[model samples]
Target chain A: MAVTLSQDGRFHRQLIFINGLLPMVLMGFDAWRGKLGVNPAEFVTRATGVMTLVFLVLTLLVTPLRKLLGWNWLLKQRRLLGLFAFFYCCGHLLTYLAFDRDWQLGTVFEDVVKRRFIAVGMFSFALMVPLAVTSTNAMIKKLGGARWAQLHRLTYYITIGGVLHYYMIVKSDATYPLWFAAVVVVLLGYRVVVSLRKARERVAVGVER
Target chain B: MNPISKIPSSEITPEETFLNRRFFMKTAIWAGSAVATGGMYRAFSPRSDVKSTGSEIATVVDSTFQSSLGADEKVNSFGEIAGYNNYYEFSTDKSAVAAKAKDFVTDPWSVEVGGLVGKPRVFGLEDLLKMESEERVYRFRCVEGWSMVIPWVGFPLAKLLSLVEPRSEATHVAFETYYDLKQMPDAGSAGIDLPYVEGLRMDEAMHPLTLLATGLYGKTLPNQNGAPIRLVVPWKYGFKSIKSVVKITLTNREPPTTWSLANPGEYGFYSNVNPKVDHPRWSQAKERRIGEAGSRETLMFNGYEAQVAHLYAGMNFEEDF
Candidate 1:
């Protein structure tokens, strides 16, 4: 905090941009060099899926961090992180459809309907579509502040569903998924405590008045 | 997860050719570059790295029980076969298994035979080796939907069971692998019940294809690939082929298996490879061969139906699975 750079500076945004794209660039290099492991398709799918979850966690951290430190520019960074989460989600789904399902839409549809894990994953991805569409400045303005904030609340449910999707898919080990669940729970728990405190403060003010 | 999985057998020198002088120099060059690049052939490349000196290499003297199945499919290099493994007693990570199991001691191992058997004898490693050996090139299929072609060296399970003389009351054969909390320290965290067990009906156990393998690719079994002695039920999923086996019991009742016990809905006692019967969580209609990029549709009984389908004749595969 002693020597802070401007939170909304172009350099800061550029840094995030470069870092966000770095995973894909490295993955591409590995693919070109034939280094995506025994099952390259599996490697790509898992990498993109994990990246999506990582971005989702970062995206939710923005609101709490901004509230605690009073760094509102972090709000500006949130949308970009959310968008990157969506971007990796796209990659995850694309790899599964092309490599795993062989672009067989009928089978994929059946998978979505039949497999609980696939159904959960598809539900989360579908929830992301509306958030992504209303992410622009004009859409935010059209929806207005209170309405936009209410709609963007979907991130909480989407992140929960994302973790569930991961938990349900793994074979035996649930250690990674459990850790993801813990982080999301703590993040959500903060909001719950803050809201309760605010309500108590308002009741005290009303009694004094 | 090693990228050497993508290296085609065509690019690799054939087994006989790779054992020569020129190939030894090539291995050194490859080793230098692999170390410089920080990967690829670092751990078990060229297969010879794991076995130092010719005497340490395991050699199979006879080709007793050969199968023509998957002959067109090139046998995976010794590195690929030994490098990637699913021995849960060692580790769950396939690529990391070889390293974790390297220090494993397979000597002083003996398998006990009992329960409803007339002879019911324990055969040590030395005596087990005397029965016979074979080179079986079979398609290896994992329950998680991946595959490989392996040239396993062993004899039929019937050959070993014959020495014990199963009793008339015996209806099923139950096999259990050796489990030591100290020897396989990591197995405590493997998330499955230990002393991995598998079972087959008596007739199925006696089938010509049920192998008691001691090695692979003509070398003695590496620790990761179930050293000393292991079962090779090619028609069933890989888990049914229990590794590091210690006990064989002929029973009158169906024996509980590890995967089935872990998740009965997803894994069944009769986990034969079938294209029509998909796993509850994931589709098993197709599988990507380990070294290949694309997937091929799975075969019923893993393409050994002609030899094994009759075993499941009256049973409904969908219900049993």
Candidate 2:
């Protein structure tokens, strides 16, 4: 049997929060040690971008994995993972602004307008801001369950946008980006199938009555 | 006997410079595969701390390499230059290239200079090294918005091209890098197409500043840095400086280049470093000078417009880029 992390355990959630920050800590350590290679700016930007994608993909996996494994506790951990994704995306955008564009709003705006990938990435990040803001329990309560759930469905579009951003920016090897795209597609497919099955069962029950 | 130019022997980077990235290769070999990062670093912490916060590339700089800091152009430390490379033949991951290329066989190599040439010949590694070696300190800019100052030791590409004696119709020169399926396992997946090719107009090939570099920092190139032979076009983006070249062909038609063939929009045939023409993906207006903080304004023609501008005197920078 494999060692398992329980979905709702507070200890595991805390562990994950620390674990999420670990990469940045290591990056800072490497930067300090002069071990981040010759191009530290590129390193930070790339590292944060990669982390954003990793967390975003992992966030997408939560619902699917929870359904398959029957681990309802995974829902309790979803907010933390989703927030980390947002955090890393912020780092990614800021690193580009600071190092690549010299904190120039005009330059970064030009990039967003002229470059398709940057535009997609910024749009995804923009979508994430509302998701992060509404993630609070109070906001969820105020919006009511059904409306909040409906709005949160935008996660699918945001994830798709993130994958598109990655696919467009890669120089040649689309292998990794393609892999991410495939996984996101499957995750989205699962939801569509589940909803269609539920609708068919509801119709069958009505006909029998 | 040909007279040679060299960086002063007094400025040779100490042996400690060799100890950094090679640590991974050694550990990977011992383990017969990749190991965890912490173990690798523990096994290879070669540099001692100076004033000891364990932070700062400047402090880690070898005294020999540090002396050049006073000069207007500080030549990057040998380790820093070699450790960060973009040899797409091995992999697209720049820093990972060193470990992947550690065991590459460069000794028994030959470059075939043939197409549209009068005297076709394949020059062995030894024969190529026999040419005069000159040390030129150049600012190397990449399309991805990063740059480095390197002291490259090699003879001009003109010296080798002249030997081949191109026919009157040979208007362009195409170059290719050495690609072995066994040695370069990552070539198949390295984003761009393999057997990397680059072209220069025949006049560009013969220009005095265009170099055929074999080494840097007064030493033979570490395998990661295109050992044995590579083209060093200082004015163009660094990718134009093809590495570990194994083939050179002179042609009447403009030759197809690797990056341009992969994606025509981002890269172009004449990838001269023009700040006015930005890469569609990133701004070329400014670049992060490697090993330094903050971005600096990128120079037109990488600050070599005075030297090589006449070649493109009539061409438009926007379209050519």
Q: Pick the candidate with the highest TM-score.
A: 1
Across B168-206, the per-residue lDDT of candidate 1 in tens digits comes to: 999999999989878875688787888899999999899
List the candidates' TM-scores in order. 0.86, 0.85
Candidate 2 lDDT by residue in tens digits, A1-209: 21223432664476557667767776778778777766777767877886787788777788888889887777888889889999999999898778766777787776778988989988999999989999999999999999988887888888899989989988777877898899888989998999999999999999999
**Where in model 2 is the C-alpha error above 4 Å?**
A1-8, B1-71
RMSD of candidates 1 onward, in order: 14.1, 16.4
Question: For candidate 1, lDDT tens digit of each residue in A1-209?
Answer: 11224443554465567667767776787678766655566667877887888899998898788888887777778888899999999999999898878888788888888899889989999999999999999999999989999998899989999999999988776767889999999999999999999999999999999
Best by lDDT: 1
Give the runs in model 1 whose Cα sits over 4 Å from its true position: A1-3, A6-8, A69-73, B1-72
Native contact recovery (fnat) for each candidate is 0.26, 0.49
Clashing pairs in 1: none
